[model samples]
Target: MPATETSAASTPGAQPSNHITEDEASLYDRQIRLWGLDAQNRMRNSTVLVLSLRSLAHETIKNLVLAGIGRLIIMDGEKVTEEDLGGGFLFREEEGAVGTERTAAALPQIKSLNPLVEVTALPTLEPFVGGDETAMITFLKREKVDVVVACDLSYAQMEAIDAAAHAAHTKFYGAGTYGFYGYVFADLGTHHSFTYTPPGKGAVKEVIRYRSMVQAFDRTNWALTHEKTSEGGSPFGGYRRVLKARQYAPEVAVPVLALWEFEKKHGTLPAGREGQAKELAEITSELQTALGVHPKLLSSSADVVSHFVVHATDYFPPTLAIVGGLLAQDVLRSISRNGWPIVNLLVVDSLRGTATSSPWGVAPDPTPP
Candidate 1:
């Protein structure tokens, strides 16, 4: 049976703790040695809301729970199917898990990972699905949610949830895995972090201002041109130089963008059916031209677009593990403020075993001397 809808505090025997117990300290000793006890304590008292229960979410939840987060609220309305068993290790057929609500199926395993972390299951995503964010904002405040991790959602859905999180003054992360490729988008509004500058210089505090998902992907921002002094000093050098200099590879970035555009236009992702690849290719070309990317730079985008269109809905465990690990690491960093968080977007290409981060509508503060 599906789990009933519930509040953040509805879980039995799961209550928020103000301080970490000595046993917890011993359990997290290695983590404490790595990032200090203060950071671990921060994680111990933080509450995170994860919106989804797919393969990606499974890996992320495992990591966060094992790390001793104070509270975790998982929201998902879908039921488990046989296909989910492939990458969703949290679900088991032996227990008659198929056809049951995804969160209910996974809750037991998540609880087993760490008994100290309070786990709440929200069987519905009602508040976040609609266009209005009022309900979502209210829910975040009511639950005192510190962070929101939305996984495997569409571009528009993520944008709406991110807006709600921003309104509630909560950090937000949007992550998804597409077969051999995956991406994570973060919006930590006006975030501050402390880092060491030199061996004896002590720690320096830095602030990073981030743009919402919509602002980051705005077509106008993509169209903006910059002066190029090297290529005949042309004032309209296009975004090629700017984008090429970023950490992301053009082949992966462009196709992903095209996939988003395609979804927005069609109201759904292509199912690797006939002619879908060609349509996606056209969208890729249009996006490249709109973004002023050089044709040669993305000349090989056709193969990538086709590949992504076919495998976009497919799930590969290795890709999920890689992307999910990155997502969890960044979430912990954001919550603890121990290290610098992802400025904006992170792309993982499992085929090449490379993960790169690119700033989208956000810039890092200058390093202190």
Candidate 2:
């Protein structure tokens, strides 16, 4: 696709489908000045599908809807639990809401967030799961959704969704926050382009080719590869490349990876219990060792592993807000074709107030489909 500038006339009180109306222009005037009318128009025309209604999803939904996306579809089949009431601002003080469906209670608040955007609440995600993907493809086709965001799903479920999105040629994101830790993964597939403005420089055009989560995970390894000798045939020639590529804190990344493995094997998170923390620590140790982290590098990671063990299934609102904010912003960047999107994985450790992103085995194949 070629680049096109916004052609909405500067006339007063114009409301066209492909062009911004006077009221919209005024409402989003500041944002238009920041990202230009074209990007706003792109966002205005795109549809996004967000899975689940957790605290993180709530924050993401708030941002995306306020940004004035054309349509937002939220799907969560469960009822509102008491725990949900504490952190999720969308569910609060509604009559007979506790045992009823979550979507019914949330739709009103979500709609109230932005009347200009269309919000649809689905009762279930059954159509989007399992080996047969016809239902998922149909859902995407019927809605003309440009992006899919999966929140708080199992690794297998997320992998399946990513595959379906890839098959449909749609952008996909999977994000989850566990207590003070969180991560976001993206599979933009081929043909993703964006415009980025540097601090002082003007707009710079960019394109990104993302690998699927499955491929990235499969290629992630801790050991050195393609080791070459220095001038004197020293064996440490490739150590710098290997270590640099693995710079993200292994203590954090290893435990997150272990959490997925634990979920996959046991079909549920290891609840905080006697010996479970030890098991988690063992898993983290195994992963860290497998990834070739120096044993001495992990001397201080005991606290991180213990934190994950106890809080892997818990949700902290503050951390959720941070991850969700970043996730939603990236979604806007993707839809507007502006700024750099998260390449593959992003991890946050709010306990220490730190975050990092690494391109885990993303293959660079930018060929347009």
Candidate 3:
């Protein structure tokens, strides 16, 4: 969600505020100490694309909107649900459909925090990653999106965003949190770099550390040939037939295709256990396709963090605060339009009270061709 068009913030309803709300001012007090109101203004004028509108996704994004980021494209095909209300704090039980109904549902809440900020949310968002990367790439190229903030997404989707950002010459910041810890990776296109945040590590970096999990399964057909004595201790039985009946899971790419199909069939997954199963199944299927695709496909530190980072934040607001605060810094450094380095890797370990950072050292912002 780049700033293709200047926002309506100066409009009567979307006017900027002089005094921030008590709660909001309090919540963002520390942030003001770091960047001050000037940076907040930059945020108000900037447009950003948030990858998903789930728990963590919604949280970070809402913070941005409240903090006064002018425009937002909250990309997601799913609608709100009981589970969404449970996990996504920004949403309420009385809220209407997320994708179809609320284009500005979250704006009022943001206004409560900062009346000056202007926000318009969009649903029915498409995935940024795909084997058919051309569509999203071309879209972003035309749309003039300034930055992309992606949350817990698939491996290929993360890679697709990285490539799209690079090709379109935009900044891409990928962040995710799970249980207690998460990492943020900033790619300053072919130029620039993140100054404050670090790169990715731990489970988030596992995809890069290990070759394609898909390819491994493809080579051995391990899932199929896997034979074991049944609980009843049957003979060397289930093994032989199991291997013969189906194709290798990875080669079949059932997971990827299935995810595609699930979205097609079910526009809005039901909330609660049912929704989790539906989404999990789709992702598992997508993983299988990685076997046949290029192992390096969609591989980037940001992509890695977005895909593998497990988010345990039960609600949305906290997630948004964390992501918004970190990503906003990256955007500020990028707007300098001067020499800067993109962060290559950032491992934030709460246990260590440390953030492992790998920067592009220093470079100039790539003047878009």
RMSD (CA, Å), each prediction: 4.4, 6.8, 14.2
- After aligning candidate 2 to the native by TM-score, how far in Å is the CA of 212 from where it should be? 1.1
Question: What digit string (tens of lDDT, one per residue) describes model 2 on residues 1-369?
Answer: 111112223224434477777778887899999888999999988889988885679899999989988778888878888888876788876565687677777887887776677677876766665446777877788779899999988888998888788888889999998888899988887778787777778877877767677766662332433232111111111352355434555557667888888888888887787887888788878876566566665675687667777887799988988899999998998999978777667788887787766655543322122
What residue pairs clash in candidate 1, if any at all?
none
lDDT for each of the candidates?
Answer: 0.78, 0.74, 0.45
Candidate topping lDDT = 1
- Residue 162 C-alpha lDDT in model 2: 86
For the record, the alpha-carbon RMSD of candidate 3 to the native fold, in angstroms, is: 14.2
Clashing pairs in 2: 222-291
Writing each residue's lDDT as its tens digit, candidate 1 over 301-348 gives 677687788788989999999999999999999888877677677878
Q: What value of lDDT does candidate 2 attain over all alpha carbons?
A: 0.74
Clashes per model (N, Cα, C within 3 A): 0, 1, 22
How does candidate 3 score on lDDT?
A: 0.45
What does candidate 2 score on TM? 0.86
Cα lDDT for residue 178, model 2?
80
- Residue 99 of model 2 has an lDDT of 76
The alpha-carbon lDDT assigned to residue 131 of candidate 1 equals: 42
lDDT of 3 by residue, 247-295 (tens): 1112112322333344445542223343455464446434434223322
Model 1 poorest 10 in a row by lDDT: 228-237
